[model samples]
Target chain A: MTVSLEQARIIIAQTFKKGSELGLKPLSVVVLDAGGHVQAFEREDGAAPGRFAIAHGKAYGAVMLGMAGRAQMARAEAQAYFMSAVNGAFGGAVVPVPGGILLRDDQDAVIGAVGITGDTSDNDVLAGLAGIAAAGLKAEA
Target chain B: MTVSLEQARIIIAQTFKKGSELGLKPLSVVVLDAGGHVQAFEREDGAAPGRFAIAHGKAYGAVMLGMAGRAQMARAEAQAYFMSAVNGAFGGAVVPVPGGILLRDDQDAVIGAVGITGDTSDNDVLAGLAGIAAAGLKAEA
Candidate 1:
């Protein structure tokens, strides 16, 4: 399905609610279309200033590299040179980590991504995944 | 010369101040060292949601390609294919416009860049330039 701003917002809103329900610290969340254009975003109170970048970078990095950040971390070790070159080339915009995942529609096409920050990378990833699932979308991995 | 975090903060703060003084909307400012590491950044209230990505991409483009975004726009004329390839490859992170600039310390060596968004592209350029100047840094342009 097409990536709609409404859908993105719904997902993000639900994610924020879940975060609050869990009593996690404030979070910054973003959704991007398959084209990587931002679809929706929300910054909770007290979210760090740079949290937006961290979330975007993780999402963009995952999309660009076609894998989760954790997977990238594993690959980065053996492909250190390649990863470094790209990292250098992208100017810190590309941060490979597990807090991001591609969103797939029922048809299994990559529709978009959800990213969150303001906790451990693992917690961030879990939140992102929850948001995607709550949106009634599926994560391929 | 090292790019101090303080200088980066000053640059971002001034850029937002200048943008607001001119009646521009909230803005996001990015500072990148010559090696393209993030020195600092700030996002103003009501700033366009994704001003963050555009600012970073604009700055990254300037630093990596060794030309301002406007110059990249000009180069895009004869280099359309290359430009498209870049856009295709980077997914929307390659913003080739004039809103970003190279920064140099007194020694005149390219040290880093600053990118701003939340206004017209011209204003974006002006904001970045203002940040650089306010920080007492020079642009190689």
Candidate 2:
């Protein structure tokens, strides 16, 4: 099943809460359903305008490719031209970055994804994991 | 000044609040800076997957053209070819419709725009106006 609105809201809220506890910069979070459609989003007050698009692209790429962001990052490095073409094909929605995390069901099926931005990519991933945990969901390891 | 993320959140929150008060269908709301960058966006749980894109297009059009959605609709009808060309120029971000509204400051300077979708266009406009009003912002009349 796809992520419900209530779950998406929880994901966003916990993502921000984690970011704040870590004393990171203002963050932007986006939750997308299996089809890569936005379900919910939030940008912290001091976050830059572009954070939403960046977070969206990251999560969209993860959900659309059925691959975690870290794997996509490796592939992007090894196949620059292919990754570039894919990015163009998706109208710049696929961002091969570390902050995109895939949400999975108990059956290991991807149900949605979370993307976080406005801090280091690793920190973003940490926050994303916290959000997924808060929602009682699984994230691709 | 540009629309802060706080204001953008209020606009989206109040837009959905008004939509619920009116018993409208699930809605998607998008807030954009005057430069047409997305500041905040949300789609209700039952909203169609494409609602976010549609709402974003409407608000982006209003902000980019410096005109209200009603005026844009009239121009779009009278000059279909021009409107088509403009839509292409903006990568399909322009949607001339009633739900798009320009947000203005105390001095009447355009600050941003809001777009709502998933209900009747007229109802969407009403919801958007309520949102802008709640945010203490002016709408281009």
Candidate 3:
């Protein structure tokens, strides 16, 4: 019933390693357990300072809604009023955008999520998906 | 993987309802998506002034570690030297204790987490579990 922190750390480390292997810039990688809690997080050296929290925020937003943040961007654009209302409703917790991906088990249930920053939003999303896959989890397209 | 403001409000409401039904004191409930970012949070009317932030910090720590904050007490105790060195790691994010629980789906994937304050640790954990359950998610033991 518990998501092992050690495993999470290992997965995060692997994620960073993958990022390095890809010759990408330093990244902040974050992992969250199914309950939408942080399982393990690491901000690579030289990565932007605020990217850590921003990546976390983006990923958290995605997991809560069971969709990608980027998908919500269109909704936000069409419903600015509703989006603004969400900002007030969550006291500023909502941030529907990309750079995050949900982690799923073999059974296809969302078990956790990964988020990455310190690169383009597209890059972040790719990195997050790679990290989840490295951990032997799947990501919904 | 975003945690919408609406989801946050729903989680908080569930947490407060569980507390009131049990005749507990007013509580502050915080929901964080996977990646250790705040999603939605609320402190019941008449709750302690600082309980909101404190509960959030603790929940952030819990989710980041993918375990209950209470569970991290031992690690924190044994790794005092290291813990102190990173005392403000994650910008004061490590709550490493039992007052929170991770949110997981049917396959045991972590989607988010909830933390509760204004009651005993046992009560807080109970309230969090109730909130996760209310959301139709499973809580790690």
Candidate 4:
């Protein structure tokens, strides 16, 4: 079960739409396929200079962690040093933030993920999850 | 005219299809907009490791050079030191390979580029050019 390009477009579009509807800032959204390759990505005009990198990092990180979004946040917080090590190990590919979310297909298998940046972490999570739901997928958690 | 994600997908799909029809190996492909940002990318199952980097470098080099595909090879041959400096400056993002081609719109303006890896450079270029044509776009020269 791979994340299709159409689904990736929906994920990116709906992520920004939800962010705007919720008064979040312009966003950079990234969707990665199960293979960790970028399926589709977009950086809205006026998005922060480095938002795309942050967004991609978050999604890559979430997928590499093999768990849903921030379900491991508490664990990461308790082991900050280990988390730092993971970041170093991945070469900054993982952001370990709320905006990164693991997505599941109908079979409930981890297929890929959506990552958003340019807004507060909480709002970024809201938009990312909303976008996944809009695409008829579930956020693994 | 920017290369939309839909167009990028078409290019990638047709490139892989062409490669298969020619009995070539599995491949990794990348499409970058004029800004050198990834619009879409794919890595076929069983593609060799490091294919993605090579593919991306090819596309990045094509777009950055503002020429069509391997058309710059002749210029590079005349100025080996200059071309070597370019490759070093771009940190290997600029590959002087045949597999990268600049995409052009109806007005013959460059909009993006496609890069493919995993097969011979000649076969990769054939697939890349075919994919661009399949998307109803031109390969700028």
Candidate with the greatest lDDT versus the true structure = 2
Docking class of 3: incorrect
lDDT of 2 by residue, A53-113 (tens): 8999889999999988898899999999988999999988798989999999999899999
Give the better candidate number (3 or 4) by lDDT.
4
Give the best candidate by TM-score: 2
- lDDT, model 2: 0.89
* TM-score per candidate, chains pooled: 0.52, 0.94, 0.49, 0.70
Q: Candidates 1 and 3: which is better by lDDT? A: 1
Report the candidate with higher TM-score, 2 versus 4: 2
Summarize candidate 3's per-residue lDDT along B29-85 as a digit string, tens digits. 777777666554455545654664567767776667676666666677888766555
Best first by lDDT, ranked: 2, 4, 1, 3
User: What is the alpha-carbon RMSD of candidate 2 to the true structure?
Assistant: 1.7
Better of 1 and 2 by lDDT: 2
Tens-place lDDT digits, model 3, residues A1-141: 323444455566676777787788987766666655655455654554356567667767667767666776777888989867876865576566677677677677777666677777777776666666666777752
Chain B TM-score in each of the candidates: 0.89, 0.96, 0.84, 0.93
Task: Please state how well chain A of candidate 3 matches the true chain A, as a TM-score.
Answer: 0.83
Instruction: State how far residue A101 of model 3 sits from its true place (Å).
Output: 0.7
Deviation in Å, model 1, residue A99 alpha carbon: 12
